[model samples]
Target: MATSSSQTLALQRNSSEQNRFMEKLMSKIFSFYDEQSLIDVTFKVSNPTALVPAHRLILAAASPYFENLFNGNQGTDPIIEINDIDSDIFERLITFCYTGQALITVDNVAAMLNAAIVLQMDDAKNRIVEYLMTRIDEYTLQSAYTLEHETKCEVLKQKIIEYETQNFIKISQSDEFLNFGAEKLQRILVSDNLNISREEDAFDAIQRWYNYDVPTRQQQLPLLIDCLRLTQFKVDFLMTHIQPLPGCELLAFKAVSWIREPTVRPMTNMRFTEPRGVSATNCGEKTILAVCSELNPKLQQYNKTEDKWQEYASINIDYGGYRTILKNDNLLFIGGWKSCATFNIVRSWNIRNKTWQNLPGMIQARRSHCVVELDDKIYAIGGRDGLSSVERYTTSDGWKLVNSLIDGRYDAGAVTLNGKIYIMGGYKIHNDKTNFYMDEHLQIKSVECYNPDSNTWTSCADMKLFHSSPGVAAHKGHIYVLGRGDEYSHVCVERYDPQQNTWSQICSLDVDPGYIACVLLDNKLWAIGGQSESAGKSCVSVFDEENFCWVERCLLPERKVCNCFVVPETLLFSM
Candidate 1:
């Protein structure tokens, strides 16, 4: 055993000595090559021709192109002519062959990468790809994308695509994006992973690209426009922007027809209607978004995994009673009141960018209105000042007055189920000649349903008791309304069945009623933050479907009149 151990130790020492010797020998070889000593082969690269000297053995060992050339050659020293590569790129590649190290920078990476691809140096190509990935940005993405096509580098291509998708808005505004060829622009526009809050931005990008070089790009407009999700565009946008663009008449007509009669006519292309990566429907991670009043401008997000609430983005203006709806990644804040003044202003908060934009306002300035999205359109229902008016917003046409409601009421609960919108009990004015002193309003138990296809409203079965400013959510084919009760501490829960046109009392919650926000998440109903008989409540409760009761989940950080909606979790944390 002692003799065997001694032999093993000797063998390890010898192996270590051999490795060090090889390292020294490689360094010497590289030094000689750097000094242009003992050069056996000369490479004459074209495009401002220049001669570069290298050792044949080192070149052959590092690249299969040189190995195959040397194996087929007959002379002791050979002169190789490379017509496609530049002299600087060829010299850099030869340096990589000798030292296994190359200076890769943004200025020359494209040319270097090309030379490496041509020489069949897999190691050099891989290193170049790694460097390119770290350096990819809006300025260099176009060059990288072009190199990807020229070299047929799948890895680089995928990385470029991912970067393009993530920073699409910024890239689209870059000079490189305007200079992109028709094919490259089409490749980006056709991506389902492009992170755009609205499809209008896609159209705007196309228009900008076209306007950059109208004479040359005009012919490609039709093909490029085909890549846009036409169904996602609002009717007004199509009419005002796309319809008059000369060649887009057909697409504009089609988009209008589809928006008006989506069920009547099947989409010409499914890809044009599919949502992008930033869309809530396509996002993998999701969270609950809580929008509080302007006084509490810090937005809150509920992390389901941790079961906690965290502060997210903030808004500048103070707002209350605004109805929020998620359209793709943009959370649309509809009509609401601020400082005793009602507003028709529509503000869009993009979850991906964490930026706010002013969209077209509604026709009616309203607060306490119920907003719901149906068939890719936003509908703002009745609100204060005895309003029975309804307005629908579309990306193509902006906001238009839709069919009026049957009974005008504010602080009503509204939710969508099975392609229809259901509005529950709300306060209504009761103008009586007998009461001469003051205007009287009372909470009513009337329910109405709106069908977008018919553009009409039909009365549904009324609830047992009136509920004003109640939290409403749709779960498992039933509409659940929580909290706003006539009597204090009598906050009742009720479920409405559209199929049977009936309402039933489910259970009562141990929290305040009105101003609560109810949302359907993970196949359950969650009621969050509202006012009670005494003060505002910050507690959150989830419906126990199996037991028909409200279960406490977690509490929010502060008590405020908050509107809760579900959004992609990435929108909350990624920004």
Candidate 2:
């Protein structure tokens, strides 16, 4: 029995070896060889007419259409004329006839698929279809549709329909959607899977589509109206916006009924999805507030559309370590640590008047502190003084004392997340060491949270390391800290989940080194000019939390470390 099993295994090994040898031989035989070829196929593809040598036996075995044509009729000269097929595509199909493989590219897949269909090459057609489906995207959606319509590929059409339905909102915003006619637009919008965040988006798209051909598309409003969920619109929106428009009579009528009766069914019978366009810089086209903390400290307003930065005014004295906040179009510069001394002075820049005004000062002098606006009131946390005292400021009422921190340390990182203020990592004088001559300070890694509802501050899990003057920002309900480190160590980028009360270390900014002067812009963390190991070049690094990488964007005209803010398309860097 053992001898018989060994003999069977040996026979299988020889068969495998013979199969590999035959594959190599076939690969060589598939190479272009015109000498003593069976037939010549003349292809009129472009300006140049070319002839490709092909084997009848290989073509007949590969494609039934080619087999039938070759076997049917033959004259004295076996020269076949092939039309309406690209020369390169025909050549690739011929190669696949012999080699059982072909190079399918994005540019050539459509032509190749057409040729495969004409020649009845099922293997080739299946391969090209797979390639086309994978490459279908926003840029090629129109081309895919054209191919599907011409070829009558039901499968391809269905793939495109699914894609268009799923990404209707994204595709509708694209220029291609704008260019398409009312018929095509209606077909796309009719899908129940159309993922629109707001009913206003559909209204806006229809308005834009109508505006594209105002004179002609007016008649097509009914076709467009049927796709819109008019009943989903609110009463105020209908009255103030849609009702004012000339073509929204149907929408306005339905919106009135929807408001009077809450249970009214929408035209599409689908729930109205709220807008999800929230981002790091939600302020659109507003004048950006630029505050530069440097010698000859300047306050500026940046107009993104014009790409212009106009200086508002300069402070009376040079200042550094000051925190600026934009509150209701008013720019406020509060507390700073300068060469001379720490400042408690507070000033305001009126955006409308472009003038400066002195606001009521804080209860305590503080600099290198963190200040954030919560519930329309500004809360100033620990600063250079390393005091536990906290203060809140309002327009109606001046600065007043609030709840103090459990641990007082200056140069801490602070941000408001999920309606609560979180303060983390700073340093205080090490009084226990008795090393006053050495100027010793201890960096604290403790983190605390302050709830505005209870007006109380409580401790949470400590950070992985001490972060002194670290850049802090809240995005998607999580707080990210980057750049600043303890005196003895450099801090890695860290993310704090409020629910878990835990910190996880991300990558370090070795390339974009320095204290992180980061601000959330365009849903990305924009790290401005900071102290860098890279020759102190004023560099900008954009951190994509989704991809978990810091991408170097551009270098500043000068190596000036400044606090930066973004408004729409413009970025304001304050040195």
Candidate 3:
């Protein structure tokens, strides 16, 4: 009996507390002038002002899609209906102009987009339509990439393509974007997922998708190039030939970025560059040297002479990580450990001096990251200080944050092609655990290609496999991926043809070097000092350029992580 009375008393107290809270709220709302008391509460009368046009008012007050239905009714028996979209959602959207707080969710985004389209708000329609395409498929998104990529309306498609491309967007049909030839969506997810740089190859993926079939056979580079120059522009037709490569998007991209842009100039210079169009095929090859860590800061080169790592001088750096190869002659290895994420220590190993020299600090420290030299400025992609945020490291501006990538990636791959950086898969933070090696990671296959020129990122082809901390090198427009990954410490090497966007398995290594750092020298790939393929032995291996083969060589006396760089006058040095 005492417990029952106590419960009843508690309920009465809670009711009193609720009434007090409501009274306070009501006091604030009713204190303004013209506010008055109703039966027992306060109320405010709303006044109307100007009258709206009858037709405009009717349209505004009526069901949004009634006009479309009315027009359809003119033809025959019309169907009339209303959707069960909640009143809360409708009110939220309707009040958006005044409150600017419509919470658009994936479930209702399509409905809202459809509403915007019905309202004939072209800007709103285009924005919502593009957003909607992301939720759908490539065929649907394809129309958005280049309206012409799908339509018989060539002129219109061309205009849209030109518009999007200028906006630095690689437009495509809705379905195509969703159904990428590469692992684009997956690549942009999380760490421990994948780390593919356009500089690496993904040939093994090509074989899996196409096989030895005629279409799969064409996915190979040598075949795709032939198709690009000779065949038609049908995605299905291109897939039908799925050579050893992946698809023809890269070819189309090259044509658009290099061939089309250079020759088809705007109004003024158009006629002048006309002659350069047909000869775009002969553009010379471009090679870049990738510098690994502070411990083994090494220079990667692709001269195609097949004489790489044949006793070249090794250059040493004073620091680790944050590597930038300048002017094709010197390597700038600045910031990393000793300083972690601070710009405290800085130096550039002059290939001429074979010794380290100093440069300005980049405002902060960056490690296990990327450096892209474009238009003479370096852009440092995302890494970690045990956090996930994207920042660009430059000497002038320091470490100013940029747009956060679609994913939190580290040990990722990045390469610059035609001035754009295609960042591939990498290991990312899977979860937050306090004890053990409790990090959980998701190996990704999605890719984000950043355009330094426009300071924007576009989604692109993804890697075939998921790997963490794989070495990447871009050679003559193809990518070579080395090092070990999650499945096996080091199992094999793969090649990715950007033109076709596919991967293929190369020769499997008798030994695998998980997280082994690699560099391209004279058309050959050289991997050095990595944890053994599950056995934990430390050694270096080389892949033959001419013949697809692997050769294991010198072993490190003590197991140590090392970075190598070409030293002027000395040969390559592994620190």
Candidate 4:
């Protein structure tokens, strides 16, 4: 171990002083540009007859290309011929080596970048990249992309790639997207980061690109189409949108068959790489459906595009504790019973096949249980059994018992957020030894969290008031509990911050909607389908983040009982 004295450790003027000294030295060296007394080299540019005088020592020191040129010269003329670059751009490159600043403009920035690459002046190239980034727009985006490839500017290329991905729908419609050569077009098309909500948009863009110059681009269709995830699209979307295009019959046939059986994968040559960045499949015009009510097997879906609720699907399932959830294109009905004996049946309606399939039933016949999907597995936790048991189910694996809850609860609210499942206030049987049956069934505010990674349960901050069948949802790492705090002021919206390990009521409902269905969609909170003063009317309210209040939105077409989970387009299904 060594220690320095206080006087020796004292810092002043620092690196700035050394930079100033170097600047003065460089300034003195540059002052001899016009003096031929010690001149050793002359640089010339073509197309405009521009000549600049320079010393070999300064030029060679600043550029490796120049250093090798001057050291391996075949003649003593002390002259260098720089061609294919504009004189103005070349002058800026040389000036940057001396002053550490390059004059950048819209007209000359691209050419300056090219010149900087030739001279290997990284500082000048970076400054030019910054300038181009600030000036990027719809008109200049194509040129920036072109310059990215020519200069091998990775920073600029990354920016351009991001810009294109975020604005894929916008850029696909532009003329520049159509004119990009096959190689460049292939690069953009293969990127899963393209911000398109629908696979049809990607298909449409490829068609337009092919149509732009049909005779010239027809041969490149196989290369271009191979980059699309054709199997991801619905059968109807394939037939309606992609099949009609010329030269699409073979691909369309494959897509249709793949939709029927996703197991039949595409040939290696035709298969596309999985999406590479943030998923683009989460947004679109989607419908929310309310399924089988207490008495009726009829199902209804909210058609957002048409602004109507239409009968979408039907299944003979009872209403009590029967929960419906939508994941990808499938809608699942988990638990709930026509009676105590019939409660364990589980079925799923596939949107692609328009068919229903029965899945492996849960170990316990429980209703009013909480179900949440995480990591492609469905978790059914807490129900009428008043047992702390929890079960997890996956496509490949059947129902497997996981850890039980610390509190034996039924009619509890559970949601998964940030890799943990949160079970909120629910009716639970007290653990009193003497009067257990008499003091059973309590709505407690106690909250518990289940971490799947550790297979353990931990306590969380409880809600302000006790609640039964409270609506709960998780978004952006926060859990929101609705209809839980105050009954008279039924708009009890409490937000739980996991980082702080605390819960606080942020907003309340204007109307007292008891036991409402809560969900977080598109980063907004929604409460739907609950009994209020005006019961029997479909009521919905959304959290207005801008004003910090709950504002009423569209109402359901009919008085639907049960719950609703939102998809891309808000869909409400009743039981």
Q: Rate the local accuracy (lDDT) of all candidates.
A: 0.77, 0.67, 0.46, 0.69
User: TM-scores for all candidates?
Assistant: 0.54, 0.47, 0.41, 0.51
Cα RMSD (angstroms) for every candidate in the order listed: 24.2, 22.4, 23.4, 19.0
Give per-residue CA lDDT, model 2, range 1-575, as digits (tens): 74474554554557767578778877666654434343455333442466777777677777778767777775223567777786778888887878677899998888888888788786787678777878776328778878977886544655676677678777777887778777667766655456677768777878877787788877777557656655566778778877666675765766577557654522212212212222213333433344555556665544445544566566565667777776533467788766668788887654434456677899888877778887557988887756888999854357999889988888788888756899998887666666556665678889999987678999998888777777788887688887555433333678897655678776666544454566765566766556455564445577754445677654443345445555433223221
Q: In angstroms, how far off is 455's CA in candidate 1?
A: 1.4
For lDDT, the strongest prediction is 1
C-alpha lDDT of candidate 4 relative to the true structure:
0.69
In candidate 4, where is summed lDDT lowest over 10 consecutive residues? 4-13
For residue 76, give model 2's deviation from the true position in Å: 92
- What ranking emerges by lDDT with the best candidate at the front? 1, 4, 2, 3
Q: Look at candidate 2 and give me any clashing residue pairs.
A: 292-574
Candidate 3 TM-score versus the reference = 0.41
Kindly report which residue stretches of model 2 are placed more than 4 angstroms away from their true locations once superposed.
Answer: 1-290, 298-316, 337-342, 351-353, 433-439, 486-491, 531-536, 558-562, 568-575
Which candidate has the highest TM-score of all?
1
Task: Write the number of the candidate with greater lDDT, choosing between 2 and 3.
Answer: 2
Candidates 1 and 3 compared: the better one by lDDT is 1
lDDT of 3 by residue, 1-575 (tens): 74474554554557767578767754553342123222121111122221111122222333334334444543122222234434444333433422223456556655554455444333334444444444534334343444333322322332333343332213222223333442222122111112222201122233333333555344343332322222223334334443324455544444344333533322211101112112211123433233433455434432334433232344554555454444333455645654443453455554433555465665446576666654335666766542345556443245566665666676777766544577778767766677667657656777777654356676766666776566666676677766554456455566776444467656656664554556554456666656654353455667764444677754533343334433223222222
In model 1, where do residues sit more than 4 Å from their true spots? 1-275, 294-296, 437-439, 531-537
Which residue pairs clash in candidate 4? Answer: 288-571, 289-573, 290-572, 290-573, 290-574, 293-575, 491-508, 491-509
